[model samples]
Target: MGTKTPTEADILRPIKNTSTTYLALVAIAGLAFVLFLIGWSYQLAEGMIVTGLSDWGSGGGVTWGVYIGAFIWWVGIAHGGIILSAAVRLLGMDRYMPVARLAEMLTIAGLSAAGFYIVVHLGRPDRMVTSVVGHYHITVHASPLVWDVTVITAYFVLTATYLGLTLRYDVTRLRDQLPDRFEPIYKGLTIGYTEREDAIVQRMVWWLALAIIIMAPLLLHGGVIPWLFAVLPTYPTWYGGVQGPQFLTIALTSAISGVILLSFAFRRGYDWDHIITDDVFRGLLLWLGFFCLLFLWLQLQQNVTGLFKPPVDVGHAAEGRLGHPVYLTAMSLVFLVLSYIFAQAIRPALFTKKRAAVAALMVLTATLLEKILFVVEGFFHPTFDIYGATPGTYFPSWIEIASITGTVGMVSLFFLTVAKVVPVVELHAIEHLQGDDHE
Candidate 1:
């Protein structure tokens, strides 16, 4: 008659069990990813001209389009995901412990998607090695593209190390119950593990969390990614001081939205109602709302400055953004989601996980649209009028469109594969819950 207590077995369910639904999900995700590969291969054989992108002036169109916008969007999600996880650890936010590892895993998947975008956008993938890696020393000083690559690599390494260290503790304790098929991975993870090192690893993780929190504003989304666009004075739509905070807020909102969607999926699939509770969803929604408010405020600041008796070029860019249907739709979606969040805050009875999930989906869709518009509109109204009377138009080609589905499928597959290898829910979370019950 009483509520059941959660145990390690609950955390390990993904590793120990498989169902028809799970297999079906794997098949669907795999098929989507394969379709993306087919698209990419065609593009590679045909060339960048196969997609919607084209050079400025002569081509009368934008060189960067959905690919670059999606790249920035994915980076924002990755940067914000790590920040959320770091905050949970550094601030001792025990209530969110259940989803901390989920956030970290999201960071890994997001960065991979972002990196993939860079390679896809390059046309010739080998240029990544020759232009970026081979010339890092020279490019690091002058190239924002190189800076973007550098920071992403650094963040990925840090997050991977942070994840590996935590897994050592869990794998060691649960080795007996774990599948022998993954014994090699377990051995490598716990190669030098000992109970005495637990305290040391905790200290190291704490410092890593602190480092991540600090680097976010200085080196990640708030810094390098926006700087890529912000420093380009030729592009009136992107040039300004407002970009840093604007990008940061959008990153946080987008990342929180992603976490909400992911948490909902795992909770439903694993029946983790008790672990990732309704209360956790409520808290996450509130945080998402807060960031959404900041995101809108930043947009207002940019619009006000641009629309009010500004330079001709700046005003033209502002007009383009305000007049765009996609931009209006994106802003409206955010406003609606924010309104629902505010209403729920007043009447807690209004909240439901399904509604929250829907809101998250809206936010994700809005952010993606906003980002793509930001990139396109910047090109549409550049300061230099090299095109003269010629007008530029753009739309995502089928290959470009399939890239999104492919990347989403890839991330989903990453989660599915990782779940079968290790517990997606942290063992520490279960231990913490049990400790609270004892108290």
Candidate 2:
């Protein structure tokens, strides 16, 4: 018998059916998030001192630590995720169509997680309102914090609008087949829908995709986020023009890796082999390799300039990074993944979905470590020696550590919940595949 064809029913399986494994995943994710909340609450009660983060100078420590690092990591993932989706649409990369919506959704989850990190790192939640919102007019020009908040909020709105418009089309066409329990959501999504609006919506989406693509390198990852650190002359490790491209490459690599892992999970859990296809995985892996190469190249550029015939401060920052085991491990992981990708490209038989997923995992881990070290070391080796000695050692307290797990759990739950409410895979993808089958 020939292989079976996928239909809308396949896309709607999670919405209509329940599984033991699904429930188990939900339980685990929920528990992790709850634990994070508990840790956060304890921090709230005991104060920011519990996080082990301290002021610089006389305090003999860095104010920013894992929280800021993780914040940047999450922002990169979010920015890159949307860019991936936008590229698929604007560039007409049909092979990646199946994963486009997944990337868009990842943007939403990632931005949400990043936003939460800001709130968590603020020490007091009210500071967000008082320090950011209340003082926005005065600080807007001077504070990178305000710039960071403004850009993130703007991008979040853009991504949400883009996702919402696409969802309207999907929800309208699949309304009858969708669960009535979610009818209100579907109705709200398609409130002003009509078949006559299809072409117009497509055009709107196209324009939006174009906008996202244009803004990515200029405004999102490559711009504001890296600029937050890059313009600061006090931090030798972070202050440089190269940060723009370096941050963009890392964002793309991390985001692509995230999409690969999510795609693999859904493909396995929903038996969506025909829908997602191994070909898609191969293409994604190739893209991952491309970005990883850029990421490493940028690192080399930074290291060489800082190490060879460099000023005193630059040499110290470079030496500190080169001497760190964490930095070495991160670089090694990316190199290994890159090598595997190249080897697989030469000999297709070497490629396997499991291996691809593993490669993605390694890249994600590598990027996270690289980003954390970037933030920590920037503060660790600043030009000014206000402390008059080495700043006291720093490590993330248990609460700080728990925040990572908690944010991850939060993202997991977002996927789990959203999957149940709507088709994670786009309806157009199914129709396109069906058309190919018919031909």
Candidate 3:
């Protein structure tokens, strides 16, 4: 890391003109806060009904409705960052070393947004303190919501800690240029700057990275997803054996694609076309293709097994999509097939053109649509809510939407603010080691 720290200007150079993206996102966050205010005001002035949540029958109702969805969505997005950065660190993937810093930062930003969104969802967002520290007299069952909060908080703290330590390693590179007075702060940052050797640094990196990977499945598929099973019956697309693992895979996939996209954009923006070459992204596209294929396979198996096996009756209508699984219907099938074709085959072909990029983009977009189908058709829709919703009829209001938007925006805000403060790229980590550090 010595003398190799990429400056703030270096990182920001690429996204400079694109401030508009962050701006719009920030505005949305502001609007969400206002919506939270309005929703709370309405609740206070007109009572709980104004904001939607009462005894809520026996179910968790609108309060946790979109909150659940939003939490999972953002968390899913954030998980990708962690796996790519921290997980890759442990896996000892040297190619990924460059973007580890950026990925870790992005993971923190996304998780922050998710946390804020959960905070806003609390109808009693104000009572979050009690929610965490407060006691529940009733015997508390293991709620997925509790797990989501707990994991997000722990991941956030852990990732932030690692990011801080790594960033210090980064700043150490610039030690010579800095004044003598700043040495102590730098020394403090590196925890006495003693863990600088490759042996010690690599060991520490291994621990953090391993902890994240082993716990990731629990935090997500275990924490956020089981609630769906508890709520939706065992037959739907969202609740079957595959959905949880599928979510984790897609998160990893999206994180991969997103990281690749950012790298390309960052390179183009910073004019680092030499260092950030197409080779970097070409490898990613191939890996992404593999992920796309696996996800498509998973989706096919879930839909086919559910569709062909049996159907449940929800009154007169076709209750579960098990009858046909219309959500992933024909369009989904076609896209999934094409995505796999392009991703698994064409994208990795030894041909050169814009084709790989185009194909990768297609696969990523289609995968996102796939995710929407997974969470929405079954989880968001009330018809699939015997175990989850009540008698069933869910229509989330403006507050939920705005609040969610704000939560996401706040995440973007976190990234923006943090980027402003810290070096986005890990210069030291990016150093091409001539010796064993190369690993």
List the candidates ranked by lDDT, beginning with the highest: 1, 2, 3
Candidate 2 lDDT tens digits, 1-439: 1167789999998788789999999999999899999999998898888877866667766788889999999999999999999998888898888899999999999999999999998889999999999999999999878899999999899899999989888888788888889878888888978888889988998999998888889988989899999999988999999999999999999999999999999999988999889999999999999999999999999999999989998999999999999999999999999999999999999999999999999998999899889988988888886767474567778887888888899999999999999888898888888887888
Q: lDDT for model 1, please.
A: 0.91
Tens digit per residue, CA lDDT, model 1, 205-295:
9999999999999889889999999999999999998999999999999999999999999989988998898889999999999999999
Query: In candidate 1, what residue range of length 10 has the lowest lDDT sum?
Result: 1-10
After best superposition, candidate 2 residue 257: deviation in angstroms?
Answer: 0.4
Task: Note the residue pairs that clash in candidate 2.
Answer: none
Question: In angstroms, what RMSD does candidate 3 have relative to the true structure?
Answer: 5.9
**Residue 318 displacement (Å), model 3:** 8.4
Q: Relative to the true structure, how large is the alpha-carbon lDDT of every model?
A: 0.91, 0.91, 0.58
Number of colliding residue pairs in each model: 0, 0, 5
Per-model TM-score on C-alpha atoms:
0.98, 0.98, 0.73
lDDT for predicted candidate 3 compared with the true structure:
0.58
lDDT of 3 by residue, 255-318 (tens): 7755775565456545554445555566666667676666667766765664553454222122
